[model samples]
Each structure stands twice: as structure tokens, then as C-alpha cells.
Target chain A: MITFENIDVVYPNGFKGLSNVNLQINKGEFVAIVGLSGAGKSTLIRTVNGLVPFTSGTLTVGDVVVDPRSKAKLRRLRSRVGMIFQSFNLVTRVSVLNNVLVGRSADTPTWRSLLGWYRAEDKELAFQSLERVGIVDKAYMRAASLSGGQQQRVAIARVLAQDPEVILADEPVASLDPPTAHKVMRDLRRIQQELGITTIVNMHHLDLARSYADRVIGMRAGEVVFDGPVEEATDEVIEQVYQRSLTAEDIVTAEATQE
Target chain B: MVTTSTAERRAAPQAATVRPEPPRPSGLVYLGLAGLAVLAFIVFWVIQESGDVLLIPLGFVTLWAPLNPVIGLVVMLVALAVCFKARIGTMAAFGALAFIMMSYWAGATVGFTLLEIPERWSNVEPRLMAFLDPNWSYIWTVRDQWLITISMAVVATLVGCAIGLVLAMYASPVSSPNKGTSQTIKAVNSVIRSIPDVGWALLFVAFIGGTAHGLGPMAGILALLMFNIGIVAKLTSETIDAVNPGPVEAADASGATLTQRNRLAILPQVLPGFVSYGLYVFELNIRASAALGIVGVGGIGSAMMLQLNRFQFENVAAILIALIVVVLLVDMFSMYIRRKLL
Candidate 1:
């Protein structure tokens, strides 16, 4: 379980990144967060592992309270809370298998890793994770050599190898084409379900979010305006959150433009 | 696939709509500033030549008569500016510097140059001809010294690279985990870099005695190591910090340890950079070793010092050839390794 108690984030310039936010998420829930760009969606999710520190709040992940994270605690929290990026951050010069193995580092000794000598079982686990994401064949190939979709799958496999308890994906499919984006989101949702990890993903396309999310949380200007199950998330509620009524014509226009 | 160019360029029209961002001055601004520099140079030259601007022919055509060195530079600059669109002005400035340096050397060497050693040959030490006659067989015989010098260069490089690697690893913000700790590492590495190798050898010589003389190679090695260590550590740590945070975050999410994260995420990313840095240090070490001969540090350079001291220009020429060969060889090796690594 993860809990945020009245969390507030104030930047040095006095901009409120997140304002008195409170939320809780349970494991196995595939939550999709929808918001306009610069709507504190990224800030809210990054606070779970203290990637962006919350100025005031009791942000707790299982047993860890993410306030003033000491180096040791931050590492411990970071180890369990995996975050994905739109950029698919794999080391370009290295093999996919080695990139996946990096998800296993906190479990090994420094010297061992330095020598490129990973543990036997960890190696096996990395390969299995690669297989799960269907990029197993590309394991020996350099990360830079893969196609965008394949690299995204490798990223997903890296997270699987991490064996994370919580996964936060920031605009995970933004860089992908619609079809590739759909497949990537589906793969992520399926993996999250299978692993039973709590997953919160930021998404732009409404249809993709509706199909993948167990619960939809909507935000605007650093405030959560709507939170409910997909069935209860009316277009009216989306209008209330977005301050723009998204009609069927709007959807058609969006689809047409995307084409 | 979205093929609509209009949609792809949705934000393109906004460039004109938005409040125009103030454009910074461009290369023309630099060109205007360069005019100031030229004015300054002219003022200095006027003062230097006692207002005799005609003696220093202001243009390219007549400057090389007794060559007002700066005039040659100005000519070169004009030629380069025409050929390379002003890019060569900078090169011309440096060229002028080189010209001044050669002039200085010419002044220093006048007495020595004037001492015309007899062109006649000696049976024991034949006349210094460009040809390596029976008299110059000693250059070939000095192969053992050449090997020893080159070997010393290699040893110095290895030691410096090792220390640099270790310091870099610990001081790296990613591995150290504490900002304060990493800062201290940066500071210590800086101090190590600031201390010169000759100074290090001199200090160590007082403590170690006789260990200092003919120890130019060791001195060169230590110096190369110290300087390279500072560079390598800073570079490697930055490289470590830059290793994409995605893999690290994944490792962390998996409940991995600090050791695990670095091992899994950081090391692989930095390996190529490490090898590249190693090669860079090797090239630096070869060049640096040549200077260690004054303090009796081993290497072909030490022999050059001895020859120069004895005023045996032929022997000095022999040592110079050996040193140049070693340096060039090191350069080739560094290039090959860097090419392969990158």
C-alpha cells in the first residue's frame, strides 16, 4: 500500500507543484492518471518514491515515510518503486540483457557488478524477464540497435526484472505511434496484473486510458478534480476536470487529426 | 500512422503568434567585437614600432621583408578570413604566437648556432653530418635505453589510471550516494591534480633518495597518474551520474541494494568511457614522460637531458628521434583504442 497525507510541494520560486494532496493506492490496481501537460501529474507520481520531494506531507510507501529521505532510505525506497519514462532510458552502448541486469544491482555487491560478474540466478531472472516482455531474442543486442517499440518492451522487461512493488510510468506511450502505443500500454497492463504490482500510469489519449485503467484520476492545475471507476467517469466529469466539454465531435476531430 | 503534415506542425504557427523572444546577437556581434581586438593590436604595434607604421607595412604584400611578425599574422588572418570566412583569424593569432616563440628560440640559439663545429670528421666522434655514418652507430646501439624509457612510460600510465579509477569510483555522486562525500572526493582529486609531477618527484626524492635520480619514468608516471586521475575521476563520476536514471530506478524498484544498483545500472554504462579515459591518459603519459628527464626520472627523455648537457647535439638529435617515435607510437595506440571503444 502507498499513502499520501496532505502532501504539498513548493518550489524555490514559490510555485506550488502539488497542493495539499491526499491519496492512497493498493497493490494490483492499474490506475491511469489523466491531466493536461504541466498539471502536476508528473509531480504527484514522482513523490511516491521521493524522486521529487514533497514539502509537507506524510507520503508513505509500505513502511517507508518519504519525508526528508536519508540516502539509505531513498535507496531502499527507490529499489522497490520502479519508474518508467517516455524516453525508454536504456544504456545505448550496452546489450539489452545487461540493461535488464541493472534492475538487479541493489541485490548484488558493488565489486561483483564492477567486474561485470552478476550472480547466476540474477542472470537467469533477467533473461526470464526479457522473455516475458517478448524481447528475449534481442537480449544480446545493443539497446540502441532496437526499434522504438522493441526498446519500450525492453524497458518493460527491465521493470519486470526489478520485481518492483510499485511502478510509476510517466507519459509512457507519448513517444510511440498510436498502434505501438496501444500495444505497449496493453503489455504494461498485462505485466502489472500478472506481477500484482501497484501501477499508476500518466496517459494522454482518453480511449487508451479508459480501456486500461481500473480507476481513473483526473487533475488540472495541480488539483485532483475527478477520481472514480471508469464506468462512473462521465464526459461531464471530464469537462468539469478539463474545463472543456469534450463532445463526440471533439473525439472525431481528435481521431481525424491523429490520422 | 498519422500522415497529416498540418497536424504535425500544429505548434509551428504559434512561433509567430507568441511574444517574440529577444534574439541574442549573432556572429556579427562577435565580428564587431573582433574589430575591437584588431584595434587593440594595432595600438600595441604602433607603440612597439615607435610610430613607424610604414616600417611595418600595414598590409600583407610588403610585411615579410624583415618580416614584422605581426604583419605576417595579419596577412595570414586576411587570407584565412577570405578562405575560411574569418574562422582562420583565431588560427592566425596562435600562428603569430608560434612565430614569436620561434623568434625567441632563434635569439636564444644564436651563440650556439654561431659555434660552427668543424665539418671535418673524427675517427672516434665523426663530423656531425645528416648521414648516420660509422660514427653515429651509437644511436642504433641505444635500443636498450629506448626500451627502458618506453617501459617506464607504460608503468607510469598504469599506476595513474588505477588511482584515477579508484578515486573516480568513490567520489562519483551516484556511487557515493552522499553529496557531501562526493564533494570531498572532488576536492581531494583537485588537490592531487594541482600538484605537479616534478614537484611530487622532488618531494618524494627527499624522502626516498637515489630513488629519485634516473627515476624520471617513475616521476613521469606519478605525474601522469595524478593529472589523469583528476580528469578521469571527474569524467567517470559525471559519466556515472549521467547513466540513464531509468535502469537505476528499475534496479531500485526491484528492491536492489546500492551495490546492486551501481553494479546492475551504472558500471556497464560507464565501461566504454573508462576505457576511453584510460587510452587518453596513456597518450598524456607519453608526452609528460619527456619532461621528467631533468630530475633524473627514467625514460628516453633523461638521455636527451644528458646529451643536451654534454652539448652533444648529435646525441641530442638521437634521443629526440627516440622520444618522438615513442610519443607517436603512443598516439597511434590511443587513437586505435578510442576508435574501437567508442
Candidate 2:
């Protein structure tokens, strides 16, 4: 389980990223977070991995506490909660298999990782993760050579290899095209179903969230305005959460909706 | 399932392609050519003179004269060719003519005859034996001094690179702990870098208040350290600044410690450059060690200088041969390492 209790994040320059936000997500649940730009969706997802620390909050992932004050504790917390980015931040100079193997550093000894000595089991696990993402044949190729959607899949393979309990994907498909975006969303859904990982995705597209998420959490100006199952998340609720009427740009499949 | 469209393949009629002609040189280029022609004619006239009016500027010209009419005719023909070409070759020919003029005025001459040898070769027999004799028995004369010179360079380069690497990390804004630390390191390095290697050597020799030959290799090594630190730190920090930050972020997100992040991400990217820099510093140190001997920091240079001062040309010759052999060996070794790095 992942829990955020009365979390508030205020930057040193006095910008509030999150304010009095509380959320509880059960294991194996798929939740989509929707918000306009600067509405704290990214801050909410990053808080789980302790990538962005909450100023006043108690965040617990499994049994580990997310405490930025203690680096050892923060590292332990990060190991169990994987975060993905819109840019698919893999080291493009390295091979795809080597990019996946970076996940093993959390488990490998410091000396071993420094010397790039991976155990046979870790190598086997990396190959299996690549196979799961259906990019096993491209594992030896450089990550920069892969297409955008393929690179995102390699990133998903990295997360799977880490075997995290809660997967935080912040705008995973925001950079992809319409058809490739649908395919990547299906891959994320399949991975979630097969491994029973708690997956939280921060998405801007309403139709994508409606199609993929079991539950939707809406935010406006650093506070959650709506929280319920997909069926209860009506168009009126989304418009209220964004504090404006929805436009065609707010939906990825707007053409289909218009027809 | 054969889907053939209504598109048909056709060939267009062929015609000759015409390329545009290149632009011609402007009148200004021809003007420059005329100026060069005037300069060459003046130089030819100067070369045929009887005295040293242009000797200093045209030192190479005085060796031969345009005394013969045939030679004068040949020079005029060359000048005419340069006038038409009006290019870099024309400018070069003008320079050659100037040198010929100077040489002719200087009354210079070419010689192939050997000069007489000094009878003091027997007095410089010990230095001669050192080179020709396989046993190198004369090495005992300056055994400790030579060792000090070699060790000073080796140790200084090794420790200097280490210190430089640390300073570079702090000097780089990206990897530094804070902005203040980065600026301070850069400031300190800039101050140290402004001092020349020989200047550092001279300062240390004076500050210690000892004979130039007796203060030990510490003075020389210290000078080398000062020089090496500036070079290595500047090169390394520039390289560190250029590394991709994406991998560093990935390492952080993957729960890597600071050391692990550097080792796995930044180190691999900069290791080759750092090795190349280290080898280059080593070569600089070797050459600088010889130079530091002038200030009496205990190197082969001091020994050779001492031999030359007493008018012992034979001894000086032996020392020069030894220095050349040592420098050649070091250069070859450094070249091999650089090739391997590539």
C-alpha cells in the first residue's frame, strides 16, 4: 500500500506544489491522476518515490518511510518505488540491455556495481524483462537508435527489471503519437495486470485516462477536487477539476469523440 | 492480393547539363600582383649591389650574386611569371628574392669542409667513456643527482594529476558541492596557472636560500606540480562539464550513492580523456625537468651546463648525446601510449 497523508510541498522560493493532499492506494490498483499544467500532478507522483520531498507529510511505501533527511532511508524508499518520465530517461549511449541492467544496482553490491560485474541471475532477469516488453532482439543495440515508442518500452523494461512495488509513470505517453500512445498504454496495462504492481500514471488526456484507469484522482491548484471510480468521473467533474470547459486538446481521441 | 496501381514508368528525354563558370579574380588581386612584381624587381637589384645595405633583411641572398647577365635574365623571366600568376607562389618568390638580396649583401658563403678538432678530447675522456663504454662506469659521478631528477618528475606528475583530478571535480559547476566552492576552486587555479614553469622554479630557488645546485629536487618537483595542477584541472573540468546529465539523473533515480553515480556514469565518460591528459603532463614534466636544471634543481641539464661553461666541448657533446637519447626514448614511449589510447 502507498499512502500520502496531509502532504504539503512548498519550494524555497515559496511556490506550493502540493497542499493538504491526502491519498491512499491499495496494491495492484491502477490509478490515473489528471490535472492541468502546474496543477501538482507531477509533484503527487514524484512524492511517492521521494524524488520531490513533501515539506510536511508522512509518506509510506510498503514499510519504508519516505524521508529526504536521511539519504539511506530515501534510497531504500526509491528502490521499491520506480518512477518513469515522459522523456524515457535511459542513458542513450549505452546498449538497451545495459540500460535495463542499471536497475540491478539497487540490489547489487556497491563494489560489484562499480566494476560492472553482474551476476548470471541478474542478466537472466534483464533478458526476461526485455522479452516481456517484446524488445529482446533489440537489447544489444544502442537505446538512441530505437524509436520513441520503442525507447519508452525499454524504459518500462527497466522498471520491470527493478521489480518495484509501486510504479510511478509521469507523462509516459505525452511525447508519443496517437497510435503509438495507445499501444504503450496497452503495454503498461498488461504489465500492471501480469505483475500486480500498484501503478499510478499522471496523464493529461481525458479519454486515455477513462479507458485505462480503474480509478481517477483529479487535482486543481494543488488539491484533489475529485476522486472516484472511472464511471463516476463524469465530464462535468473533469471540467470542474481543470476549472474550465474541456477543449478538443484535452482528449487524445478527440476525433473519434467528435464523430 | 497483388495490388497494382495505374502508375506507369516513363523515361524523360535527355539533355546536356550546363555548369556555371567559376568567378574570375578581381582587379584588386591583379593590383596585389603588380605590387609583388615591383617588390621582387627591387630585391633583385639589391642583390646585385656591392655592399651590405640589405644584408640584415636579406641575409640568405648574399651567398650568390646576379653578376652574370644570364642569371639576371633568368631572374627577370621568373619575375614576369609571378606577375601573371599573382598568387601565393608570387608572394613566396618575392620573399626568396629578398633573402637572396640580403645574402649577397652579407657576403655569405656555403661550406662543406670540416673544421679542426680540439686536442682536449683526452681530457674529456671520462665523459666519452660514459657513452662509448658499455659498462657506463662514469655514471657513478652523478648517480644520485640523475636519480633525483627522474624521481622528481615521476612523483610530481603522479601526485599532481591526483590533486588536479580532485580540484577539477570541485571546479566544475555541475559536479561541485555548491556554487561558492566551484568559483573558489576556479579562482585558485587561475592564479596558479598564470605563473610560468620557470618562474615558479626561480621563486622556489630564491625562497629556500640555498645554492641552485643543492636545494634538492623538491624545488623542481614543486614547480612541475604547480604547472601540472593548472593544466590537468582545466582540461578535466571542461570534460566533466560536457558529460551527459541524463545518465547521472538515471543513476540517482535508481538509488545510486554519490560515489556509485560518479563511478558508473561520469567516470566512464571521462576516463579516456583523463588518461590522455595524464600522459601529456608526464611528457611536459620530463622536458621541464631539463629546463629546471638551469636554476640548479638537480637534473642532467645542470650537469650539461656545468660541462659547457668550462669550454669542455667534448664533455658538452657527450651530455647532449645522452640528453637526446633520453628525450627520444620518452617521446617514443609517450607516442605508443597515445596510440594505444586511440
Candidate 3:
């Protein structure tokens, strides 16, 4: 379980990223946070793993109080929580297997990781992760050689190799085309269902969120405006969350058709 | 109303056709021309009086004659005409004129004269003939010294590249643990790179007591090693700084420590660049070690200097050919490795 109690994040530059936010996420729940640009969706999700530390208030992830000040605590927390980025973030010069093996870095010995001597079990895990993502054939190829969609799948394999309990995806499909976006979303959804990992994704595509999320959290201007099941998040609630009426641009399917 | 306006426009063109005035050179151009003329007069006065002319040593060569003023006058006039006629920008025309004048001034200061080469040819005829008939047997004598030089280059380049790779990691802004560490490493690297290879060799030779003390190769090795470290660290750090930050962020987010992050995310990206620089430094070390012997550090260069002192031009020529062949072979080998790696 993850809980945030009156969390506030004020950047060093004095920009308020999140203000007095309270949230409770249960285990095995797939939640999608939706907002317009600068609506604090990414900031809210990043706080779970302490990537963006909350200036005040207490955060609890899996029964441990999240403390950004303690390096050991933060590392332990981050080890159990996997984060994905808009960019695939794989080292393009290395083989896909090597990139996936990086997910095992926290568990491997420092000397072993430095020397690139992975244990046999860890290598097997990496190959299994790649198999899960259906990119096993490209495991030895450089990450730069893959297409965008293939690279995203490789990123998913990397996360799977980490074996985290909670997966936080920040705009995972924002850089992909519509069809590829849906495929990646489907992969995330399938993995969430199969492994029962608590997955929270930040996205701008309302249709993808509504289609995949069991619960939807709407954020606007550093505040959570809406939180409920997908059925209750109607157009009116979404418009209120966005502070504007929806357009074709807000829906991935609609925008894809216009193109 | 449109028809009437069209008729008026047609009649307006027939009234008068005045051509616009052609653009004239700016005042800055004339000022630059006047400055060049003044500089020319100073040059002429210096050449005539032969005063305040710095004669830089060009080995056995000397100045042949004073520059002719008529040639200088013709070149200046032609430059001034082009500046005015081309109507280029003031800055560009001034820059061109200033560059030409600076070249002439530098040449005159250095006492550069093409005619001196032919005039002194007779003096070099004996050496040329001796060089053409090189003593092939001299190679057996200096073969060990040549080996020492090549070995010094190989060891220095390899060991220096290893240390340099680590220092480069600490020096780069992206891979460094903190800003203070990065800046300190960069400052030290700059200090090391500022001194030339020969200067380092001389310092070591002075401290270690030269070849007579049986430590000449050690001095040469130390000098080349320092030079290699300076060059490789600076270049590899620049490559490290330009690596993709995305993988670094990913590693951090995966809970990897600093060392782990650098090893997994940073090293692979810069490995090719580091190896390429290592090979290049090896090539440079080969050539540099050949000259360190002049400062009393033992190598093929010391042997060559000894031959030159004893007036054995033929043996010097033989050693030169061998050095050239070895350098060419190393160059080819390095290029092949770089092509395969990159």
C-alpha cells in the first residue's frame, strides 16, 4: 500500500509542484493519473518513489515511511519501486541484454556489477524478462538499432527484470504513435494484471486511461481534483479537472483518426 | 478609380528614371588603409636601417637580403584598390588587410628568405651525398636503443590511458560525484597539459641525472606518461560529458549507486572514444620519445644526437629511415584498430 498525507513539494526555485496532496493506493491497483500539461500528474507519481521529494508531510510505501534524507531508506524504497520515463532511457551503445541487466544492479554485488559478471540466475531472469516482452530475439542487439515501439518494449523488460512491486510510468507512451501507444499501454496493462503489481501511470491520453485504469486520479495545478473508479470519471469531471472542455487532442483515438 | 490610378502609374515612370547612387567604402576602410600605409613605412624604415629586427634562429640558415620596397608598394596598392572596388564590409576588408600585413610583419621579423636555401646548397652537398649512401650496418648498433624507445612509448601510453580513464570520470561534470571534485581535477589536468613533453623530459633528466646515472629511459617514460595522461584525460572527459544522460537517470532510478551508475551507464558510451584516444596518444608518444634523447634521456634520439656530434651523417640517415618505417607501421596498426573499434 502507498499513502501520502498532506504532502507538499516546493522546489528550491520556489515553484510549488504539489500542495497538500492526500492519496491512498491499495496493493495490486492499476491507477491512471490524468491532467493537462503542468497539472502535476508527473510530480504526484514521482513522489511515491521519492524521485521528487515532498518538502513536508509523511509518505508511506509498503509499510515503511519514505524518508528522502536517508540514502539507505531511499535506495531500498527505489529498489522495490520501478520507474519508467517518456524516453526509453536505455543506453543505446550497449546490448539490450546489458541494459536489462542494469535492473539487477541493486541486488548484485558492487564488484560483480562493475566487472559485468552477472550471476547465472540473473542472466536467466534477464532473458525471461525479454521473453515476457516478446523481444527475446533482439536481446544481443544494441538498443539504438531498435524501433521506437521495440525500444519501449525493451524498457518494459528492464523494469520487469527489476522485479519491483510498484511500477510508476511517467508519460510512457507520450513519444510514440497512436497504434504503438495502444500496444505499449496494452503491454503495461497485461503485465499489471499478470504480476499484480500496483501500477500508477501518468498520461495525457484520457481514452487510454479510461480504457485501462481501474481507478482514475485527476490532478490540476498541484491538487487532486478527482479520484474514483473509471466509471464515475465522466466528461464533466474530466473537464473540471482540466478546467476546460475536452477537444479531439485530449483523446488518443480521436486525434489518430483526424491524422 | 483603379483605371485612373493605373494610368497615373504608367505616366509616372515616363517622367523620370533616376539611378540610385552606388555604395561607397565606409570611412573605417580608409582609416584601415592609412594604418596599413603607416605600417608599411615603418617596415621600410626598419629594413633600411636594419634596426630592431629580430633574427630568429633557423638552425644553419640566415637571412639572404632586405625586402624590396617596390614589391611591397605594389602589393599594398593592389590591396587598397580591391578594398575600395569590392565595397565589402569595413570589418571584412580591414580583417583581410590586417591579416596580410601581420603575415608580412611576422615573416620580416623571423628573417624568412627563400633565396637562402639555394645559396647555402653547396654547404649541404656533402651531407646529402653521405645520406644517399646510408651505412646499413649502423642498424645493428642502435637496434637496442630503438627497442628502448618503442617500449617506452608502449608502456607509457597503456599505463597513462588507464589512469587517465579514471581521472576523466572524475573530471567530467556529468559523471563526477560533485562540482568541487570535477573542477579540481580539471584544474590539475590543465596544469599538466600546459607543460610541453620536452620540458617535462628536461625536468626529469635534471632530477634523475640523465643517461650517465643509468635512468635515462625512466625519465623519458615519465615525461611521455605525463603528456599522455594530460591529453587522454582532457579528451575522454569531453566525450564523457557528451554521453546520453538518459541512461544515467535510468540507472539512478533503478537504485544503483554512483559507481554502479558510472560503470553501467557511462563507461560503455565512452569506451570507443577512450580507446581511440589511447591509440592516438601512443602514436604521439612514439614521435615524442624519439626527441626526448636530445635532453640526455636515452633513446634512439640520443643515439642520433651522438652520431650528429661525431659527424656520422650516413649512420644518422640509416637511423632516420628505421624510425620512419617503425612510425609508419605503428600508424597503420593504430588506424586499423581504430577502424575496427569505432
Candidate 4:
């Protein structure tokens, strides 16, 4: 379970990244947080992995309380909850398999991993994870050579290879085209369902959240303005949360184009 | 009328709502100041060196001829300044040219007024040595000396680099990971670097003198090794510091232990730096080994000093050229590897 109870994140430079972000995500839940730029969606997700330290807040991932002040605890927590980013974040020069194997570093003995001697079982696990994401064929290919959608898939495989219980994806499809974005979201949703891992995805497209998420979270000005089941998250509620006039044209256009 | 108004509004430009003054030409003032300053210096320097002539065969060259040594001389001066600033190549070529043109002729003129050893000594090989010099058997006699010194240089370089590399890894900010250990390693490296190679040779000669059969070459090789280690480490650290933190972070977050992260994540990224730094140190050590010979460590440097003392300039020429050839070849290889890295 990942929970943020009145979490307040003030960056050292005095930027209020997340303010009173009270939210909860249960195990095996597929929740999507939607917001425009600077809306605290990323900050909320990053809290789970302890990457972005909240200045004042209570964030619990599983049983561990994330406190950036405690480096060791943060590192231990990071090893459990795998993260995927917009940029793919795989080493550009390394091969796809090597990139996936890095996900195993959290579990391997330090010296054996250091000496490039990953256990045989770890290698088998890496291959199996690649197969799950439909990229086992590109195992030896350089991560840089793959297309954008392929790269995102490779990143998913890397997290899959981690065998992480919860995955946090921050704008995972923002850099991708619409078709590729849909495929990646579908893949993430399918994988999360199959693994029964609690998955939280930060998304920009309203249709993506509606299509893939069991629950939708809408944030505005560093606070959750709307949180409910997909069925209850109506156009009026989205309009209130976004503080923009939602139109019938938007719904019609979004639906038509996604076809 | 309404449709035309809408089209006009669209044509008016989205950006026309605000116009920012093109960023002021702030760079021009600096350029103008620099140009004026350069002009002033030329005028002032010309006035200072008024008596020295800068004669150019401008008219003759305009008339039609290829060899304009004056223009060539100007090119030479500019190239020398650039080489001095950037160190474009080995210094030997410039040093040799200076000796041939300036030192040989100018010193002979001074020697004419000073010690006056006949105008003809000119480091010329005399007929006596040419006729009496030993042939094939002499090389066979000295083969053991050559082999041992060559083998010692190789062993010393590898052994020294192994120790140096381990130390460098610890001394590097990347390897230490923490600030305190990194600072301590830097202090030790600085102390090691301050002792000059010659001082090392002299100290070793005093304690570990050629008491053992081949200790003379051993001592020279060791000093070269120590100095080159410092040079390699200093050159290599920047690459280590500049290593992409993303991969390392990925490895770390994956639960990689520090050693595993370095080997799996860090080493692959830094391989190019290692290759280039290793070759650069190898070249430096070669030249250094020759210098080490002067402190009773056996090599061409000692041989040159011996010939200089005996006034046997011909033998010195042969040895200097051989050493230059070796240095140049190594320099070429280093250049090739560096090009590949970039």
C-alpha cells in the first residue's frame, strides 16, 4: 500500500511542489492521476519511490515511511518500487538486456554484480521479463536503436525484470505519439493486472485515464481536486478540477480521434 | 466583411501583440574594444623595437617567385605561438630546429671569442673511430644489456600502472563516493606528485643502487612509473567525474552494491578514458626513462652524457635520433587512440 496523508512538499528553492496532497492507493489498484503541467502529479508518484523528498509529509510505501533525510531507508524503499519515466531513462549506449539486468542490481550481491557476474537465475529472469513486454527479440539490440514505443516497452520490461510490487510511471507516454501511447498504456494496464501490482500512472490525456484506469485522480494547483471511480468522474467534475470550461466538442473530438 | 476581418486578424500575427527589442548588440562593444587594443599594441611594440629590421622581399615576391622566406618566417612565428599555447605536437622537432639554426651557428661564433676549440670540431665523426669501430660481435656482447633494460621498462610500466590504477580509482571522486575519503586520497596523490622523477632516481640510487645486477634500470623504471601514475590519474579523473550519473543511479536503485555498480554500470562508460590515459602515460614514461639514465640508471641519457664528456658528438647524435624515433612512434599511436575516443 502507498499512502500520502496531507503530504506537503516544499522544494529547497521554496517552490511548493505538492501541497496537502492527501491520497491513497491500495494493492493491485490501477489508478491514473491527470493534471496539466506543474499540477503535482509527478511529485505525488515520486513520493512512493522516495526520489523526491517531501519537506513535510507522511508517505508510506508498503510498511516503510519515506523520509529523504534517511538515505539508507530511501535507497531500500527505492529498490522495491520500480520507476519508469518519460525519457525511457535506459543507458543510451548499453544494450537492451543490460538495461533490463540493471533492474536486478537491487537484489544481487554487490561484489558478484560488480564483477559482471550476475547469477544464472537473474539472467533467466531478465529474459522472462523481456518476453512479458514483447521485446525479448531486441534483447541484444542497443537501447538507442529501438523506436520510441519500443524503448518505452523496453523500460517496462526493465521494471518487470525488477519484479517490483508497485510501478510508478511519470508521463510515460508524453514524449510518444498517440498510437504508441495507447499501446504502452494498454501494455502497462495488462501487465499490472497480470502481476496484481499496485500501479500509479501520471497521465495528461483524459481519454487514456478513462480507458485504462480503475480509478481516476484529478489534481490542480498541487491538490487533488477530484478522486473517484471512472463512472463517477463526470465532465462537470473534470471541468471543476481543471478550472476550465469543458465542452461537448472536447469529448466528441477526443473520442473520434482515438478511433 | 466579417470573414475578411477574421482573415486579417489571423494574418496580423500571433506574436505582433508584443514586440521585444531584438536583444541589444551587447557583444559588439567587447569586439570593438579588443580590436582597438590589438591595434594599439602593434603600434607600441613597433615603436619599442625600432632598430630591429623586419625586412620583407615583398616586391621580389610580387614579381614572381615561390621561396618567400620572410612570409615563411612569419608563418613559423605564428605556428610557434600556437604550438606553445596549445602544445600541438612533440617539442623535439622545434628543439632540433632551434639547435641547428640558432645554437650551432650562434654558439660557434661565441666559441670563437670564448674557448676556441678549432672551428672544425662541429661534432663531426673523425676518420679514426670510423676505421676502428667494432662490428657485429659488439652488438651480441651488449644484447643482454639491451634486452634487460627493455624488459624492465615493460614490467615497471605494467606494475606501476596496476598500483596507480587502484590508487587512482580510490583517489577519484567517483570511487571514494564519500567526500572525506576522496579528500584523503587527493592529499596522498598530491604528496606523491610533488617529488620529481630525478629526485626519485637519486633517492633510489642511494638506497637501492645497482647492488643487485639490474637494479640500475630497475630504479629508473620505478621513478618513471611513479611520475607517470600521477600524470595518468590526473588526466583520468575528469572523465570519471563527468561519467553519466543516470546509469550509476539506475544501478544503485536496482540494489547494486557499490562494487557491482562500478563494474557493471561505471566501468563500461569510462573505458575510453582508461585507454587514452594509459597510452599517454606510456609515452611520458618512455621519454622519462631516457632522462632517468643520467642518475646511473642505464639508458641512452647516460650514454649521451658519457659521449658529451668524451667530446664524441657523433655517438650522441645516433642515440638522440633513436630516442626521438621511439617517442614519435608512441606519440602517433596515442594520437590515433585519442581520435577514436573523441
lDDT of 2 by residue, A93-147 (tens): 6689988888777887888877788899999989999999899999899898999
Candidate 2 local Cα displacement, residue B83, angstroms: 36
| TM-score per candidate, chains pooled | 0.75, 0.63, 0.86, 0.71
Candidate 4 chain A: 10-residue stretch with minimal lDDT = A249-258
Off by over 4 Å in 1: A245-259, B1-136, B169-176, B210-220, B234-263
Question: By TM-score, highest first, what's the ranking?
Answer: 3, 1, 4, 2
Q: Model 4: residues >4 Å from true position, as ranges?
A: A232-259, B1-175, B187-214, B298-300, B332-342
Native-vs-model 1 lDDT? 0.71
Q: Model 2 chain A: which ten-residue window has the lowest total lDDT?
A: A250-259
Backbone clash pairs for candidate 4 read A105-B254, A105-B255, A106-B254, A106-B255, A114-B260
Q: A137-218, model 4: which lDDT tens digit per residue?
A: 9999988899999998988888888888898888898888777888888889999989998999998777778888999999
Candidate 3 lDDT (Cα, 0 to 1): 0.88
| Clash tally for model 4 | 5
For candidate 3, what is the total of clashing residue pairs?
A: 0
- Model 4 reproduces a share of the real contacts of 0.51
Question: Best by lDDT, which number?
Answer: 3
Best by DockQ: 3
DockQ of 1: 0.37
lDDT tens per residue, model 3, A11-127: 899999999999999999999999988989888988888878899999999989999888778877888888888999999988999999999888988999989999999999999
Stretches > 4 Å off in candidate 3:
A12-14, A254-259, B1-80, B101-115
